[model samples]
Target: MFKKTMTTIGAGVALAAAGVLASGTAAFAHECFNPNRSEQGNAGASHSQAWLTVHIDELTAGLPEDDAECVLDAYAATGAPTSFTIMVKGAVGQDGTIASNNPHPEKAGDGSGIDEIFAAHGADIVGSFEECGVPMPF
Candidate 1:
Protein backbone atom coordinates (compact mmCIF):
# COMPACT_ATOMS: atom_id res chain seq x y z
CA MET A 1 0.00 0.00 0.00
CA PHE A 2 2.88 2.42 0.79
CA LYS A 3 4.52 1.62 -2.58
CA LYS A 4 1.26 2.27 -4.40
CA THR A 5 0.78 5.60 -2.57
CA MET A 6 4.30 6.67 -3.48
CA THR A 7 3.68 5.87 -7.14
CA THR A 8 0.46 7.90 -7.15
CA ILE A 9 2.19 10.89 -5.56
CA GLY A 10 5.02 10.68 -8.06
CA ALA A 11 2.55 10.66 -10.93
CA GLY A 12 0.77 13.70 -9.52
CA VAL A 13 4.05 15.63 -9.21
CA ALA A 14 5.01 14.80 -12.80
CA LEU A 15 1.65 15.94 -14.07
CA ALA A 16 1.93 19.22 -12.16
CA ALA A 17 5.37 19.89 -13.61
CA ALA A 18 4.12 19.22 -17.14
CA GLY A 19 1.20 21.56 -16.58
CA VAL A 20 3.52 24.37 -15.44
CA LEU A 21 5.79 23.96 -18.45
CA ALA A 22 2.84 23.90 -20.84
CA SER A 23 1.44 27.08 -19.33
CA GLY A 24 4.75 28.85 -19.67
CA THR A 25 5.05 27.89 -23.33
CA ALA A 26 1.52 29.03 -23.99
CA ALA A 27 2.20 32.39 -22.34
CA PHE A 28 5.26 32.92 -24.51
CA ALA A 29 3.35 32.02 -27.67
CA HIS A 30 0.47 34.49 -27.26
CA GLU A 31 2.19 37.54 -25.79
CA CYS A 32 1.62 39.95 -28.66
CA PHE A 33 -0.61 42.99 -28.48
CA ASN A 34 -4.20 42.58 -29.66
CA PRO A 35 -5.39 45.94 -31.01
CA ASN A 36 -8.97 44.79 -31.46
CA ARG A 37 -9.53 44.15 -27.78
CA SER A 38 -7.04 46.58 -26.25
CA GLU A 39 -6.71 49.66 -28.38
CA GLN A 40 -4.42 52.39 -27.17
CA GLY A 41 -6.50 55.04 -25.50
CA ASN A 42 -6.20 58.46 -27.18
CA ALA A 43 -2.91 57.55 -28.74
CA GLY A 44 -0.88 60.48 -30.04
CA ALA A 45 -3.27 62.82 -28.33
CA SER A 46 -1.96 66.36 -27.76
CA HIS A 47 1.31 65.44 -29.42
CA SER A 48 3.01 67.76 -31.84
CA GLN A 49 3.78 66.75 -35.43
CA ALA A 50 7.47 66.88 -34.67
CA TRP A 51 6.91 64.80 -31.57
CA LEU A 52 4.85 62.29 -33.48
CA THR A 53 7.36 62.16 -36.30
CA VAL A 54 10.21 61.66 -33.89
CA HIS A 55 8.24 59.04 -32.00
CA ILE A 56 7.54 57.13 -35.20
CA ASP A 57 11.14 57.36 -36.34
CA GLU A 58 12.23 56.05 -32.99
CA LEU A 59 9.83 53.13 -33.28
CA THR A 60 10.94 52.22 -36.80
CA ALA A 61 14.59 52.98 -36.32
CA GLY A 62 15.88 49.42 -36.80
CA LEU A 63 13.28 48.30 -39.32
CA PRO A 64 13.95 47.76 -43.02
CA GLU A 65 14.24 50.84 -45.20
CA ASP A 66 11.17 49.96 -47.21
CA ASP A 67 9.17 48.95 -44.16
CA ALA A 68 10.12 52.09 -42.29
CA GLU A 69 9.34 54.23 -45.29
CA CYS A 70 5.98 52.55 -45.62
CA VAL A 71 5.13 53.32 -42.02
CA LEU A 72 6.22 56.93 -42.36
CA ASP A 73 4.25 57.41 -45.52
CA ALA A 74 1.13 55.91 -44.03
CA TYR A 75 1.41 58.07 -40.95
CA ALA A 76 1.95 61.15 -43.06
CA ALA A 77 -1.10 60.45 -45.18
CA THR A 78 -3.30 60.08 -42.18
CA GLY A 79 -2.60 63.66 -40.99
CA ALA A 80 -4.33 62.75 -37.79
CA PRO A 81 -3.42 61.63 -34.31
CA THR A 82 -2.04 58.10 -34.73
CA SER A 83 -0.42 55.20 -32.94
CA PHE A 84 2.06 52.75 -34.41
CA THR A 85 2.84 49.16 -33.55
CA ILE A 86 5.88 47.55 -35.09
CA MET A 87 5.69 43.78 -35.50
CA VAL A 88 8.89 41.94 -36.23
CA LYS A 89 8.83 38.45 -37.69
CA GLY A 90 11.90 36.18 -37.82
CA ALA A 91 14.26 39.10 -37.33
CA VAL A 92 14.06 42.85 -37.34
CA GLY A 93 14.23 44.53 -40.79
CA GLN A 94 14.32 41.19 -42.62
CA ASP A 95 10.61 40.60 -41.99
CA GLY A 96 8.44 43.21 -40.29
CA THR A 97 5.09 44.94 -40.62
CA ILE A 98 3.91 48.18 -39.05
CA ALA A 99 0.42 48.85 -37.87
CA SER A 100 -0.95 52.41 -37.55
CA ASN A 101 -4.26 52.35 -35.75
CA ASN A 102 -5.52 55.89 -35.35
CA PRO A 103 -8.87 56.99 -34.04
CA HIS A 104 -9.81 59.61 -36.59
CA PRO A 105 -13.32 60.80 -37.08
CA GLU A 106 -12.95 60.57 -40.84
CA LYS A 107 -11.66 57.00 -40.82
CA ALA A 108 -15.06 55.60 -40.15
CA GLY A 109 -16.02 53.34 -43.11
CA ASP A 110 -13.15 54.83 -45.11
CA GLY A 111 -11.14 51.62 -45.59
CA SER A 112 -8.05 53.30 -44.16
CA GLY A 113 -7.22 50.77 -41.49
CA ILE A 114 -3.76 49.26 -41.18
CA ASP A 115 -4.30 46.54 -43.79
CA GLU A 116 -5.76 48.99 -46.23
CA ILE A 117 -3.08 51.56 -45.55
CA PHE A 118 -0.33 49.01 -46.02
CA ALA A 119 -1.99 47.75 -49.20
CA ALA A 120 -2.33 51.27 -50.52
CA HIS A 121 1.36 51.95 -49.92
CA GLY A 122 2.45 48.68 -51.62
CA ALA A 123 3.87 47.37 -48.36
CA ASP A 124 4.05 43.62 -47.93
CA ILE A 125 1.53 42.40 -45.42
CA VAL A 126 3.42 40.14 -43.02
CA GLY A 127 0.16 39.52 -41.23
CA SER A 128 0.20 39.32 -37.43
CA PHE A 129 3.20 38.09 -35.49
CA GLU A 130 3.98 37.93 -31.79
CA GLU A 131 5.02 41.37 -30.45
CA CYS A 132 7.64 40.90 -27.80
CA GLY A 133 7.95 43.13 -24.67
CA VAL A 134 4.18 43.25 -24.26
CA PRO A 135 3.20 42.70 -20.65
CA MET A 136 2.48 39.02 -20.03
CA PRO A 137 -0.73 37.47 -18.67
CA PHE A 138 -2.61 39.61 -21.19
Candidate 2:
Protein backbone atom coordinates (compact mmCIF):
# COMPACT_ATOMS: atom_id res chain seq x y z
CA MET A 1 0.00 0.00 0.00
CA PHE A 2 1.04 3.63 -0.47
CA LYS A 3 0.75 4.21 3.30
CA LYS A 4 3.12 1.36 4.03
CA THR A 5 5.62 2.61 1.48
CA MET A 6 5.47 6.15 2.91
CA THR A 7 5.95 4.85 6.42
CA THR A 8 9.07 2.94 5.40
CA ILE A 9 10.46 6.00 3.65
CA GLY A 10 9.78 8.20 6.70
CA ALA A 11 11.57 5.78 8.99
CA GLY A 12 14.54 5.61 6.67
CA VAL A 13 14.77 9.39 6.58
CA ALA A 14 14.61 9.64 10.36
CA LEU A 15 17.34 7.06 10.81
CA ALA A 16 19.59 8.83 8.30
CA ALA A 17 19.08 12.15 10.04
CA ALA A 18 19.92 10.68 13.41
CA GLY A 19 23.10 9.13 12.01
CA VAL A 20 24.21 12.50 10.69
CA LEU A 21 23.51 14.28 13.95
CA ALA A 22 25.34 11.67 16.01
CA SER A 23 28.43 11.87 13.80
CA GLY A 24 28.49 15.65 14.03
CA THR A 25 28.17 15.59 17.78
CA ALA A 26 31.02 13.10 18.09
CA ALA A 27 33.28 15.25 15.91
CA PHE A 28 32.66 18.39 17.93
CA ALA A 29 32.76 16.66 21.32
CA HIS A 30 36.58 16.61 21.40
CA GLU A 31 37.46 19.64 19.32
CA CYS A 32 40.02 20.99 21.80
CA PHE A 33 43.38 21.03 20.06
CA ASN A 34 46.17 22.88 21.87
CA PRO A 35 49.23 23.43 19.67
CA ASN A 36 51.28 24.88 22.54
CA ARG A 37 50.32 22.25 25.07
CA SER A 38 53.25 21.71 27.38
CA GLU A 39 54.38 18.47 28.89
CA GLN A 40 56.85 20.20 31.23
CA GLY A 41 54.25 21.68 33.56
CA ASN A 42 53.35 19.92 36.79
CA ALA A 43 49.69 20.99 36.60
CA GLY A 44 47.54 17.97 37.27
CA ALA A 45 43.87 17.41 36.49
CA SER A 46 41.46 18.17 39.29
CA HIS A 47 39.50 15.28 40.74
CA SER A 48 36.33 17.38 40.60
CA GLN A 49 36.48 18.43 36.92
CA ALA A 50 33.10 20.05 37.26
CA TRP A 51 31.35 21.65 34.26
CA LEU A 52 31.13 25.48 33.97
CA THR A 53 33.42 25.68 37.04
CA VAL A 54 36.34 27.00 35.04
CA HIS A 55 36.42 30.53 36.39
CA ILE A 56 37.33 32.75 33.45
CA ASP A 57 35.82 35.83 35.03
CA GLU A 58 39.01 37.85 35.25
CA LEU A 59 40.63 36.61 32.09
CA THR A 60 37.42 36.87 30.09
CA ALA A 61 36.47 40.11 31.77
CA GLY A 62 38.41 42.09 29.22
CA LEU A 63 36.74 40.36 26.31
CA PRO A 64 34.14 42.41 24.44
CA GLU A 65 30.64 41.34 25.38
CA ASP A 66 29.42 40.88 21.80
CA ASP A 67 31.70 38.15 20.52
CA ALA A 68 31.72 34.97 22.55
CA GLU A 69 33.05 32.97 19.58
CA CYS A 70 36.24 34.98 19.18
CA VAL A 71 36.90 34.81 22.90
CA LEU A 72 36.30 31.10 22.99
CA ASP A 73 38.48 30.58 19.89
CA ALA A 74 41.40 32.53 21.29
CA TYR A 75 41.13 30.65 24.55
CA ALA A 76 41.13 27.48 22.53
CA ALA A 77 44.26 28.55 20.66
CA THR A 78 46.40 29.66 23.61
CA GLY A 79 44.79 27.65 26.39
CA ALA A 80 46.66 29.95 28.81
CA PRO A 81 43.99 32.52 29.68
CA THR A 82 41.57 29.68 30.18
CA SER A 83 44.02 27.93 32.49
CA PHE A 84 44.06 31.02 34.69
CA THR A 85 40.30 31.68 34.48
CA ILE A 86 39.20 29.71 37.54
CA MET A 87 38.28 26.29 38.82
CA VAL A 88 35.02 27.57 40.32
CA LYS A 89 31.96 29.34 38.94
CA GLY A 90 29.65 32.26 39.95
CA ALA A 91 29.20 35.99 39.43
CA VAL A 92 32.48 37.41 38.13
CA GLY A 93 33.36 41.01 37.43
CA GLN A 94 35.16 42.80 34.63
CA ASP A 95 38.13 43.16 36.94
CA GLY A 96 38.07 39.41 37.67
CA THR A 97 36.48 39.94 41.04
CA ILE A 98 34.00 37.37 42.31
CA ALA A 99 30.82 38.33 44.09
CA SER A 100 27.76 36.58 45.47
CA ASN A 101 25.34 38.99 43.74
CA ASN A 102 25.22 40.92 40.47
CA PRO A 103 25.76 38.93 37.29
CA HIS A 104 28.17 40.51 34.78
CA PRO A 105 26.66 43.24 32.61
CA GLU A 106 27.89 41.78 29.36
CA LYS A 107 26.34 38.43 30.21
CA ALA A 108 22.94 40.12 30.52
CA GLY A 109 22.83 41.60 27.03
CA ASP A 110 22.04 39.94 23.69
CA GLY A 111 24.89 41.55 21.69
CA SER A 112 27.60 41.03 24.27
CA GLY A 113 30.50 39.83 22.18
CA ILE A 114 33.05 38.77 24.79
CA ASP A 115 34.95 36.36 22.55
CA GLU A 116 35.30 38.79 19.63
CA ILE A 117 36.82 41.32 21.99
CA PHE A 118 39.31 38.77 23.30
CA ALA A 119 40.16 37.55 19.82
CA ALA A 120 40.78 41.12 18.68
CA HIS A 121 43.25 41.59 21.50
CA GLY A 122 44.34 38.07 22.23
CA ALA A 123 48.00 39.05 22.01
CA ASP A 124 47.58 41.41 24.95
CA ILE A 125 45.98 38.94 27.38
CA VAL A 126 48.01 36.44 29.35
CA GLY A 127 47.29 32.93 30.69
CA SER A 128 47.89 29.32 29.66
CA PHE A 129 46.42 25.84 29.55
CA GLU A 130 48.86 24.93 32.25
CA GLU A 131 46.95 27.34 34.43
CA CYS A 132 43.58 25.78 33.59
CA GLY A 133 42.80 23.03 36.12
CA VAL A 134 41.31 20.68 33.54
CA PRO A 135 41.84 19.50 29.98
CA MET A 136 40.36 21.84 27.34
CA PRO A 137 38.68 21.35 23.98
CA PHE A 138 40.60 23.37 21.42
Candidate 3:
Protein backbone atom coordinates (compact mmCIF):
# COMPACT_ATOMS: atom_id res chain seq x y z
CA MET A 1 0.00 0.00 0.00
CA PHE A 2 2.82 2.40 0.86
CA LYS A 3 4.51 1.69 -2.47
CA LYS A 4 1.32 2.52 -4.37
CA THR A 5 0.92 5.78 -2.44
CA MET A 6 4.50 6.83 -3.22
CA THR A 7 4.03 6.11 -6.91
CA THR A 8 0.91 8.23 -6.98
CA ILE A 9 2.71 11.07 -5.21
CA GLY A 10 5.58 10.94 -7.64
CA ALA A 11 3.21 11.05 -10.58
CA GLY A 12 1.46 14.06 -9.11
CA VAL A 13 4.77 15.83 -8.61
CA ALA A 14 5.78 15.15 -12.19
CA LEU A 15 2.48 16.46 -13.50
CA ALA A 16 2.81 19.60 -11.41
CA ALA A 17 6.30 20.22 -12.68
CA ALA A 18 5.16 19.82 -16.26
CA GLY A 19 2.39 22.31 -15.71
CA VAL A 20 4.84 24.87 -14.36
CA LEU A 21 7.21 24.42 -17.29
CA ALA A 22 4.42 24.67 -19.80
CA SER A 23 3.23 27.94 -18.33
CA GLY A 24 6.74 29.35 -18.36
CA THR A 25 7.19 28.41 -21.98
CA ALA A 26 3.92 29.99 -22.91
CA ALA A 27 5.02 33.22 -21.24
CA PHE A 28 8.08 33.44 -23.46
CA ALA A 29 6.42 32.54 -26.75
CA HIS A 30 5.84 35.99 -28.12
CA GLU A 31 4.80 36.51 -31.77
CA CYS A 32 6.15 39.22 -34.11
CA PHE A 33 4.80 40.46 -37.42
CA ASN A 34 5.55 42.96 -40.12
CA PRO A 35 4.13 46.43 -39.69
CA ASN A 36 2.06 48.22 -42.32
CA ARG A 37 3.63 51.14 -44.15
CA SER A 38 1.36 53.54 -42.28
CA GLU A 39 2.53 52.14 -38.98
CA GLN A 40 6.12 52.41 -40.12
CA GLY A 41 5.66 56.07 -41.02
CA ASN A 42 4.10 56.73 -37.65
CA ALA A 43 7.13 55.34 -35.80
CA GLY A 44 8.59 58.82 -35.30
CA ALA A 45 12.23 57.95 -35.99
CA SER A 46 14.89 60.27 -37.36
CA HIS A 47 16.24 57.47 -39.51
CA SER A 48 14.66 57.22 -42.91
CA GLN A 49 11.43 55.27 -42.96
CA ALA A 50 12.31 54.22 -46.47
CA TRP A 51 15.52 52.66 -45.25
CA LEU A 52 13.87 50.95 -42.34
CA THR A 53 11.06 49.54 -44.46
CA VAL A 54 13.53 48.01 -46.84
CA HIS A 55 15.89 46.51 -44.30
CA ILE A 56 13.66 45.70 -41.37
CA ASP A 57 13.91 41.96 -41.78
CA GLU A 58 17.68 42.06 -41.81
CA LEU A 59 17.88 44.30 -38.77
CA THR A 60 15.42 42.21 -36.82
CA ALA A 61 16.82 38.82 -37.71
CA GLY A 62 17.61 36.29 -34.96
CA LEU A 63 15.35 38.00 -32.46
CA PRO A 64 12.09 36.57 -31.20
CA GLU A 65 9.55 37.20 -33.95
CA ASP A 66 7.55 39.62 -31.87
CA ASP A 67 10.64 41.42 -30.69
CA ALA A 68 11.79 41.79 -34.26
CA GLU A 69 8.47 43.29 -35.22
CA CYS A 70 8.69 45.66 -32.28
CA VAL A 71 12.14 46.80 -33.29
CA LEU A 72 11.06 47.28 -36.89
CA ASP A 73 8.15 49.50 -36.00
CA ALA A 74 10.16 51.39 -33.42
CA TYR A 75 13.05 51.98 -35.78
CA ALA A 76 10.81 53.00 -38.63
CA ALA A 77 8.73 55.40 -36.59
CA THR A 78 11.65 57.15 -34.97
CA GLY A 79 11.24 60.51 -36.74
CA ALA A 80 13.83 62.40 -34.73
CA PRO A 81 16.76 61.69 -32.42
CA THR A 82 14.57 62.43 -29.41
CA SER A 83 11.89 60.04 -30.59
CA PHE A 84 14.42 57.33 -31.22
CA THR A 85 15.88 57.84 -27.79
CA ILE A 86 12.46 57.69 -26.17
CA MET A 87 11.50 54.48 -27.95
CA VAL A 88 14.69 52.81 -26.86
CA LYS A 89 14.18 54.01 -23.33
CA GLY A 90 10.61 52.71 -23.33
CA ALA A 91 11.61 49.28 -24.57
CA VAL A 92 14.13 49.04 -21.75
CA GLY A 93 11.58 50.12 -19.16
CA GLN A 94 9.30 47.31 -20.27
CA ASP A 95 12.01 44.66 -20.08
CA GLY A 96 11.16 43.74 -16.51
CA THR A 97 7.43 44.10 -17.01
CA ILE A 98 6.96 40.85 -18.81
CA ALA A 99 3.22 40.73 -18.40
CA SER A 100 2.85 44.11 -20.07
CA ASN A 101 5.41 43.68 -22.81
CA ASN A 102 4.31 44.07 -26.41
CA PRO A 103 5.60 45.11 -29.85
CA HIS A 104 4.89 48.77 -29.33
CA PRO A 105 7.99 50.03 -27.52
CA GLU A 106 6.98 53.62 -28.08
CA LYS A 107 3.84 53.08 -26.06
CA ALA A 108 5.86 51.95 -23.06
CA GLY A 109 7.41 55.18 -21.83
CA ASP A 110 7.19 58.76 -20.65
CA GLY A 111 10.32 59.44 -22.78
CA SER A 112 12.78 60.04 -19.92
CA GLY A 113 15.99 58.11 -19.23
CA ILE A 114 19.11 56.88 -20.99
CA ASP A 115 18.71 54.92 -24.24
CA GLU A 116 21.56 52.49 -23.87
CA ILE A 117 19.32 49.46 -23.56
CA PHE A 118 19.35 49.00 -27.32
CA ALA A 119 23.11 48.94 -27.39
CA ALA A 120 23.09 46.02 -25.01
CA HIS A 121 20.06 44.11 -26.32
CA GLY A 122 19.73 45.11 -29.97
CA ALA A 123 22.74 43.58 -31.63
CA ASP A 124 20.85 42.06 -34.56
CA ILE A 125 19.03 45.29 -35.30
CA VAL A 126 22.19 47.38 -34.95
CA GLY A 127 24.20 45.02 -37.08
CA SER A 128 21.54 45.11 -39.76
CA PHE A 129 21.74 48.88 -39.80
CA GLU A 130 25.48 48.73 -40.26
CA GLU A 131 25.27 46.13 -43.00
CA CYS A 132 22.59 48.12 -44.77
CA GLY A 133 24.58 51.39 -44.65
CA VAL A 134 22.76 53.40 -41.96
CA PRO A 135 24.42 52.70 -38.65
CA MET A 136 22.67 53.92 -35.53
CA PRO A 137 23.83 57.16 -33.93
CA PHE A 138 24.90 55.43 -30.74
Candidate 4:
Protein backbone atom coordinates (compact mmCIF):
# COMPACT_ATOMS: atom_id res chain seq x y z
CA MET A 1 0.00 0.00 0.00
CA PHE A 2 2.79 2.42 0.84
CA LYS A 3 4.61 1.60 -2.42
CA LYS A 4 1.50 2.19 -4.48
CA THR A 5 0.79 5.49 -2.78
CA MET A 6 4.35 6.68 -3.36
CA THR A 7 4.19 5.73 -7.04
CA THR A 8 0.93 7.59 -7.55
CA ILE A 9 2.29 10.70 -5.85
CA GLY A 10 5.46 10.61 -7.96
CA ALA A 11 3.43 10.30 -11.16
CA GLY A 12 1.26 13.21 -10.18
CA VAL A 13 4.27 15.35 -9.46
CA ALA A 14 5.85 14.47 -12.80
CA LEU A 15 2.66 15.32 -14.66
CA ALA A 16 2.39 18.61 -12.84
CA ALA A 17 5.98 19.47 -13.73
CA ALA A 18 5.30 18.68 -17.39
CA GLY A 19 2.27 20.89 -17.35
CA VAL A 20 4.28 23.75 -15.92
CA LEU A 21 7.01 23.35 -18.52
CA ALA A 22 4.50 23.35 -21.38
CA SER A 23 2.81 26.47 -20.09
CA GLY A 24 6.17 28.22 -19.68
CA THR A 25 7.06 27.52 -23.31
CA ALA A 26 3.73 28.82 -24.48
CA ALA A 27 4.17 31.93 -22.38
CA PHE A 28 7.44 32.82 -24.13
CA ALA A 29 6.07 32.25 -27.62
CA HIS A 30 5.00 35.52 -29.19
CA GLU A 31 3.84 36.51 -32.66
CA CYS A 32 5.29 39.68 -34.15
CA PHE A 33 4.04 41.21 -37.40
CA ASN A 34 4.68 44.43 -39.27
CA PRO A 35 2.01 44.86 -41.94
CA ASN A 36 3.84 47.84 -43.44
CA ARG A 37 7.31 46.34 -43.68
CA SER A 38 9.40 47.63 -46.54
CA GLU A 39 8.93 44.43 -48.53
CA GLN A 40 5.16 44.62 -48.34
CA GLY A 41 4.25 47.84 -50.19
CA ASN A 42 5.02 51.50 -50.65
CA ALA A 43 8.34 52.09 -48.89
CA GLY A 44 8.00 55.46 -47.23
CA ALA A 45 4.27 55.29 -46.72
CA SER A 46 4.36 51.81 -45.27
CA HIS A 47 7.34 52.47 -43.07
CA SER A 48 5.75 55.59 -41.71
CA GLN A 49 2.63 53.76 -40.59
CA ALA A 50 4.48 50.72 -39.25
CA TRP A 51 4.10 49.33 -35.72
CA LEU A 52 5.23 46.24 -33.83
CA THR A 53 2.70 44.09 -32.04
CA VAL A 54 2.70 40.91 -30.03
CA HIS A 55 0.74 39.61 -27.09
CA ILE A 56 0.99 42.99 -25.32
CA ASP A 57 2.73 41.00 -22.63
CA GLU A 58 5.40 39.68 -24.99
CA LEU A 59 6.55 42.78 -26.78
CA THR A 60 10.16 41.67 -27.11
CA ALA A 61 9.82 37.93 -27.61
CA GLY A 62 10.37 37.49 -31.35
CA LEU A 63 12.13 40.78 -31.99
CA PRO A 64 15.90 41.06 -32.02
CA GLU A 65 17.52 42.94 -29.16
CA ASP A 66 18.63 45.66 -31.56
CA ASP A 67 15.18 46.05 -33.02
CA ALA A 68 13.76 46.39 -29.55
CA GLU A 69 16.30 49.08 -28.84
CA CYS A 70 15.38 50.87 -32.02
CA VAL A 71 11.76 50.79 -30.99
CA LEU A 72 12.63 52.35 -27.64
CA ASP A 73 14.90 54.85 -29.34
CA ALA A 74 12.07 55.86 -31.64
CA TYR A 75 9.78 56.23 -28.68
CA ALA A 76 12.45 58.51 -27.29
CA ALA A 77 12.12 60.46 -30.49
CA THR A 78 8.42 61.02 -30.00
CA GLY A 79 7.61 64.05 -27.88
CA ALA A 80 4.21 62.84 -26.61
CA PRO A 81 1.07 64.70 -25.37
CA THR A 82 1.67 67.08 -28.26
CA SER A 83 1.71 64.02 -30.53
CA PHE A 84 0.42 60.45 -30.61
CA THR A 85 1.03 57.81 -27.96
CA ILE A 86 2.50 54.33 -28.22
CA MET A 87 1.79 51.84 -25.48
CA VAL A 88 1.18 48.19 -24.78
CA LYS A 89 -1.57 48.01 -22.23
CA GLY A 90 -3.20 44.68 -23.01
CA ALA A 91 -3.21 41.74 -25.36
CA VAL A 92 -4.83 41.87 -28.77
CA GLY A 93 -7.64 39.41 -29.12
CA GLN A 94 -8.45 37.32 -32.19
CA ASP A 95 -11.01 39.96 -33.08
CA GLY A 96 -8.23 42.62 -33.11
CA THR A 97 -9.04 45.05 -30.35
CA ILE A 98 -7.25 46.17 -27.18
CA ALA A 99 -8.22 46.76 -23.57
CA SER A 100 -9.89 49.99 -22.52
CA ASN A 101 -6.81 50.97 -20.53
CA ASN A 102 -4.78 51.16 -23.74
CA PRO A 103 -4.72 54.79 -24.72
CA HIS A 104 -3.56 54.45 -28.32
CA PRO A 105 -6.36 54.45 -30.87
CA GLU A 106 -4.52 52.43 -33.50
CA LYS A 107 -5.04 48.71 -33.88
CA ALA A 108 -2.33 46.09 -33.40
CA GLY A 109 -0.30 44.59 -36.32
CA ASP A 110 -0.25 47.90 -38.18
CA GLY A 111 3.31 49.08 -37.54
CA SER A 112 5.69 49.76 -34.65
CA GLY A 113 3.52 51.98 -32.52
CA ILE A 114 6.74 53.22 -30.96
CA ASP A 115 7.99 54.26 -34.36
CA GLU A 116 4.75 56.02 -35.15
CA ILE A 117 4.82 57.78 -31.80
CA PHE A 118 8.40 58.90 -32.36
CA ALA A 119 7.61 60.09 -35.86
CA ALA A 120 4.74 62.15 -34.55
CA HIS A 121 6.29 63.56 -31.38
CA GLY A 122 10.00 63.55 -32.21
CA ALA A 123 10.97 63.91 -28.54
CA ASP A 124 13.95 62.33 -26.82
CA ILE A 125 13.23 59.65 -24.23
CA VAL A 126 16.69 58.16 -24.27
CA GLY A 127 17.75 60.51 -21.51
CA SER A 128 15.99 58.37 -19.00
CA PHE A 129 17.62 55.26 -20.41
CA GLU A 130 20.92 57.05 -20.16
CA GLU A 131 20.21 58.06 -16.60
CA CYS A 132 19.64 54.41 -15.81
CA GLY A 133 23.17 53.75 -17.17
CA VAL A 134 21.87 51.13 -19.54
CA PRO A 135 23.47 51.02 -22.95
CA MET A 136 21.15 51.24 -25.93
CA PRO A 137 20.90 47.84 -27.60
CA PHE A 138 20.40 49.41 -31.04
What lDDT does each candidate get? Answer: 0.30, 0.30, 0.34, 0.32
Native-to-model Cα distance after best TM-score fit, residue 73 in candidate 2, in Å? 1.1
Q: Judge candidate 2 at residue 131 and give its lDDT.
A: 46
Residue-level lDDT tens digits of model 3 in 14-34: 333323433342211111111
Residue-level lDDT tens digits of model 1 in 18-67: 23433441211111122332233323421321111112233344567766
Q: Against the true structure, what is each candidate's TM-score?
A: 0.22, 0.19, 0.20, 0.20
Q: Show model 4 residue runs off by greater than 4 Å.
A: 1-51, 54-115, 121-124
Q: Which residue pairs show backbone clashes in model 1? A: none
Best by lDDT: 3
What tens digits encode model 2's per-residue C-alpha lDDT throughout 1-138? 996565345434333332343234121111111223233221332222211112233333334554444545555675444432112222235232122232442431122222121222223233332343322222
Residues 3-72, model 4: lDDT tens digits: 6565445434333332343234221111222323443332332233232221111222345766556555
Ranking by lDDT: 3, 4, 2, 1
Error of 3 at 42 (Å): 23
Q: Tell me the lDDT of model 1 at 60.
A: 47
Please identify which of the two predictions, 1 or 4, would achieve the higher lDDT against the true structure: 4
Top candidate by TM-score: 1
